[model samples]
Target chain A: MPEELPPLGDKVYLDSAAAVADIPDGAVILLGGFGGVGVPENLLAAMADHPARELTIVTNHAGFGERGLAVLFRQGKVRKLICTYAFHKSAFVFREIYMAGKIELEQIPQGTMAERIRAAGAGIPAFYTPTGVGTQAAEGKESRGFGGREALLEHALPGDIAIIKAHKADRLGNLVYRGTAANFNPVMAAAAPLTIAEVEAVVEPGEIAPEAVHTPSIYVNRVVLGENLELRSEA
Target chain B: MNSDPKLEAAALTPGDIARRIAREIPPGAAVNLGIGVPTRVANHVEPGRGVMFMAENGILGAGPRPAPGEEDWDLINASREPVTAVPGASLFGHADSFAMIRGGHVDIAVLGALQVSARGDLANWTVPGAGKGGIGGAMDLATGARQVFATMTHLMKDGGLKLLEECSYPLTASGVVGKLFTDIAFIEFTEEGPLLREVAAGLTAEDIQRVSEPRLLVAGTIGTLTREPEAAEPGA
Candidate 1:
């Protein structure tokens, strides 16, 4: 039988020192977050530590300073950062590298990025949004009307592997996430080719009641358990 | 102020008025700058005090101006204008970004204006000649800002002054305007609304009135014009 997503544990360690994606170089990783608030921190750290290079990161801001996706930029692991909002809090090192043309960057509007992530998770090929119709985001992208007003049609994203975070998970792969971390994890978990999550606690199967599970056991692949959650860590 | 002046020592040129507008904005305020002349304001924001900027397309703590040959193609402004994301900036989803604007989080909004009548109705972004200017977050900012400031030429594109009895275009936010920094003079919306706040260094009230299409309320006390930003000169 063809494998969908792996049903692993709800609770797993999202430690960069422990386990994470073994993504081959030149792979596309769809990063999910709206600013650093919803970022998968531990997963990001693991990716940073890994030896992989030439990554095309699909993210909004890619984080700023010494934290989040900016670390990847500092390491030169990213070949491209495909997203918007480069003006507000870009990492200093990332800016220097990008200015040097050491990497390729694809800019998308803030609104379009959000809708595209939603589209990928929902299994839709493409959807139109009224956000970027008349501006530069509409450049080369197709435009159509939904309710008389024009909206831009953005393509859905399918990644080679999906990394995410959770607050608590059962051994059966059921997950529950806290506030801001809860933003993109469920959808990201559902849309990737391989979905791995790191959680603070891992309990026995059925230990987490069906009512409390944020993500069902059907979508998860491998579960790495870590005891203490890093400051806002995820896949 | 009534029109009809030949020449005077206090009259300011259009360029000088640009200078004055630059001095009005504070050094560090979380700003959502509107397009057109307001975009020019970013170049003048003093470097390094950490002014957090918001672009509805999803950036916080946005940087100002890119160094020559340093433009990050993957990172841009709400206009998709090539820009550099500042240190400590973060990118996120559109919804969360808009939440900041709609939630009254931005400190101030500086935008361009097409018309500012004696009664301060702002007409910018779209003027009907242009198709669907896409309000984007302009409406959110106009009403959301702790203060709404505008920068524009004193006249219409057809050589007519943009100052009018009231705005000809659709209103974005009624009575939301706090100040008007123009190329001719510095005006503000007061309890009386759209009162003449200040005159340029080399300009007089009568000179301002002559160029303005509409009548202006003269300031009771003569005020001085602000100086344009130094960064604007470098880019220009």
Candidate 2:
């Protein structure tokens, strides 16, 4: 912690290394991304070199190729993965590790995964949803019939911290996302005890319109620039 | 998309099965298409129709794939394939999108199948004990949609019937499939049991029966299935 803060409503700007320094080993991390979009790239790069080990990562998909969470998996940082899709065409690393019994996996239906995270943010302990009633996803869980159909009991999925990406941020840490990059970032920010956001640019408060902010400043603890934002491909 | 080009020449292709299912999509209905054979339904939806395409990955009003070299990584589908969105498109998070589905906002969901039981129980996400078995979103879509339509080949590659008396594989959902469109026939799951609605051209009702383990009920108005849009009567 620093001795003196910059000013009221000014989020502490940290370099990638300092931003990730507090995340301890075996932390339950909520990662914001869908496919390759909206991934906290620089933070993940920092994590590649960081000493945090045996992490439990919760995200939408098992990342493909050699980037994002796949890199974390490759570095042997992930102990367990809780996600929606464990198998996809781009899954090179997870397939090898998971099949070899080197890692643990808990596959939740996509909607159920999102709702569980959102439920944590909303301070709800549990809710009944019709997502995985009769499937393997509902195994060993309590279920009841509602309106002549089964609804599975799902609990909240709170996390120690959320590392997310956004397009822009204000000094107050209000965020704005570009395109479909908005998928999990907003919800994950609210679901965690601490939230670190990676942004393309951080401007003064008045620069971003009030209503345009996708994630309010209160949910964010720190902000880091992704560095060389222009080179980041939107395609 | 056909993953196997060698099987493309095989009759009752995935595309052909998709076309048959596309005709059942009522105009102005909000529809969700699962990955695999059902994903091709977006290509067959008639333009300017009021149909709203929903993807569980948080997109509504999703359109067909963009022309070559015009891909937008930010605008991809649930399958992670680059796609375009129709006018009035809406982007949301996974929770909201599935809320639309489970809350009964979506009118129809078309899915691929490994096995559809006589009672409409569906198993598509896995081959029993396969290392790659993962359910994804099929369980949600199966239980959520107002109406569910399954599209796939009638038989497995080894000449085994996919329409069965009971699902031997793990089920994605139970008693939810309303209809099934296959390469060889169109079948409906009713309170009574599996009803054979229509058979493909040059194929007899007995041909489908020979492969089916469940007793199939032939529809009173059963006819040969056709691809020409005009061949289907308006709202037939």
Which candidate number maximizes lDDT?
Answer: 2
**Positional deviation of residue B202's Cα in model 2 after best superposition, in angstroms:** 0.6
> Model 1: number of clashes?
37
Model 2, residue A101: what's the lDDT?
Answer: 82
In model 1, the runs with Cα more than 4 Å from the true position are A1-18, A207-209, A226-235, B1-236
Across B1-236, the per-residue lDDT of candidate 2 in tens digits comes to 21333322334656667777888898999999888778877667787678999887678888877788887767777676777888998888767877888888999999888999999999988887646656777888888899999877877777777899889988888899999888778999999999999987667788778778899999888877754443332211
List, for all models, the DockQ compared with the true complex. Answer: 0.05, 0.57
A40-156: candidate 1 lDDT, tens digit per residue:
677787787898899888765545666768778888899887755453424466667777878786666444555566667678899766544444556797877766756667797
Q: Model 2, which residues run further than 4 Å from truth?
A: A1-7, A228-235, B1-10, B227-236
Q: Please provide, for model 1 over B1-236, each residue's C-alpha lDDT reduced to its tens digit, 9 standing for 90 to 100.
A: 33323323344444454455556666677788776666666655566645677666557766755786775443556555655677777665444655566457777788777776666666664565422333445654665567888777665545666777777775555566788887557888777656787876767788787776656778889787645444446464
Worst 10 residues of 2 chain A by lDDT: A226-235
DockQ of candidate model 1: 0.05
